[model samples]
Target: MNKLLKTISVSVLGAAMLSPVLSTVVFAATAASEQQATRNLVQQLSNIKSFSANFEQTTKATAGTKPAQRTGLSAQHMNQTFVGEMKVERPGKFYWETKTPAKQTIVTSGKTVWIYDPDLQQAVRQTLDDQVANTPALLLSGNTAQIMQAYRVAQPDQSKTYYRLYPRVKDSAFQSLTISFGTNKAPNMMVLLDSLGQTTSIRFNNVKVNPSIPASVFNFTPPKGTDIINQ
Candidate 1:
């Protein structure tokens, strides 16, 4: 569940729209040109009110990293591919579901978050607090200025417009994040490198921008016999 949450946080961060506040303080180490480029990219996505897409996610351990012995799984088992669907509405509402390898659902109603695992008949509920708000998923849409301050942005590929971000904070969940946009300026793919040397890539398909997503999509009710954990 922890691993899943981390993946969702990074993936959703790439998919969510940035807030409209254009004045942001970039890292002092970043060049002025790169900062402006990053701001332009943010402005391009600020108009999106909602986003929905089908995604294919692949996670693999980087070479030289040993497989997780705690889980008693081989390197191949640790490397996985999943197909999922995601929906996001402005002001903090989202739904993410993984359909393959296992079925898991995560939904947030702007105030409360629910994570459900059908196979285990368990659900975890959490309140939206300051700590949670700082996560990549929420930060992307919550405050553009703050997110810019938190990460150093760079456009490594001028021709491809690849926006790469490195967290300035020490406790960041992932080491770095890279997002690639389609011709229409919609995010087509995102790659996340975690501290454990695991690389997770999510490719988006059939993306719908500013779609009329129903509010009910962000609401979740645990089924009967499910064990509920609150935090």
Candidate 2:
């Protein structure tokens, strides 16, 4: 459970150099532009009522960073990949199922979240409060105002639709988050960098925006004989 939680916190949540001797006026102008860009990004995310996508997630150590060792696998083999499906609805509801590398399902119904591991026949239930809602995992389904307050958004290239968000809080789960949008202005990819120097990249495929999703999709019930832990 500890391992799973760590993965969720780092891989799920998760930027930049500046020119020296830049003028104060230039700096002010840049800050104003970034603020506007942040608002625009927030609006784009707010417009999403429902989202569903097939995703490929890859995790690797940063260059020059030592990779953590795992049983039967050397540090050089630390890179891991997983394919998954994700669904989200506005106001705190989402479903994430990892299909390969390992099978795990995480679903939340506004008020509560459930993490299920089929192999272990275990399910962990957690309350979905403000703290949990602030995580990057729930970014699409969380409060936009809170998001705006928590991160400083920057769009390095106005020509491109990708935005990088730096956490305002020092103890944030990850170091930074980069979200990329397609030509249609739909999110297509996300990259998360953790403090431990691990990078997790998630690319979305067959993305659906504001689609009609059944409410049941956000609710999960452990099967018979499954051990349940509440947190």
Candidate 3:
């Protein structure tokens, strides 16, 4: 279950460990304008120093067999939703805590990243740069060239609110990513398609941008008796 939760968290970073999803997917010349628009969007998001939001995360796995031919629902292809809260600050700080389906917290200060699972009584620690090195979430603190180098951006629809990002690297964790912005020009939703075609979708509500956040929120200390693993 801890492993599953870890995967869930990673999936949310979009192409990284689950809510941050935008990376290198280079496009053809025909998509020049759309690509430019994507850069513009990134520039806007980069200006935000802090962000908080309520999120509903749904993970849809692939079926082992064709459901159409199967008599019963396949657990392999089951869909699950988890409710959570997300907080982000510039220069590589983030916090995510799940309140339902299980209780877990993933926090990254500027220096270290911690993934804590209360039910398992364990926490994993690693350097922040290594954990988020190639993830889409790194875009929050990265430059436009970094984003453009990894992904090709395009707006598939007439609605400027939606943007599609495809990985230029063939070996990316997810196949593609799509992020939707609300009227306030803040990201309200993000969906990632993994290599296996499974989709991880997250919806953000009650989003507050550039709000002040306490420094302690990014720090974590394993509780008494909790096992700590350094990665």
As for candidate 1, its clashing pairs are none
Q: For residues 41-143, what per-residue lDDT tens digits would candidate 3 score against the true structure?
A: 6766766778889988776655563545332223442476778888888767878898887788888777777889999999988775532544654444444
**Per-model TM-score versus the true fold:** 0.80, 0.82, 0.75
Question: Relative to the unseen true structure, what is the C-alpha lDDT of residue 115 in candidate 1, on a scale of 0 to 100?
Answer: 86
* Candidate 1 residue spans exceeding 4 A from truth: 8-32, 68-77, 137-141
Mind giving the per-residue lDDT tens digits that candidate 1 earns over 1-231? Answer: 444555521333222334579654433333236667678657755766788889887777768876552232245546678789988887778787999988889888789888899999999999977566555444434556666777787765444556777888898777888777777666778787777767777788999888898888989999999999998
Worst 10 residues of 3 by lDDT: 7-16
Report the Cα RMSD per candidate. Answer: 9.5, 6.6, 10.0
Candidate order, TM-score descending: 2, 1, 3
Candidate 3 lDDT (Cα, 0 to 1): 0.66
Error of 1 at 228 (Å): 0.7
Looking at model 1, which ten-residue stretch has the lowest summed lDDT? 8-17
RMSD of 3: 10.0
Which residue window of length 10 is worst by lDDT in model 2? 6-15
lDDT top scorer: 2
Candidate 2 residue-wise lDDT, 1-231, digit = tens? 222222321221112325576633322223227778887788788778888999877766778775343322335435777788999998788898988888989899899989899999999998887667766667878778888898888876655667878889898767888888886567888887767676667788999998999998997989999999999
lDDT of 1 at 165: 78
Question: C-alpha displacement of 84 in model 3, angstroms?
Answer: 1.0
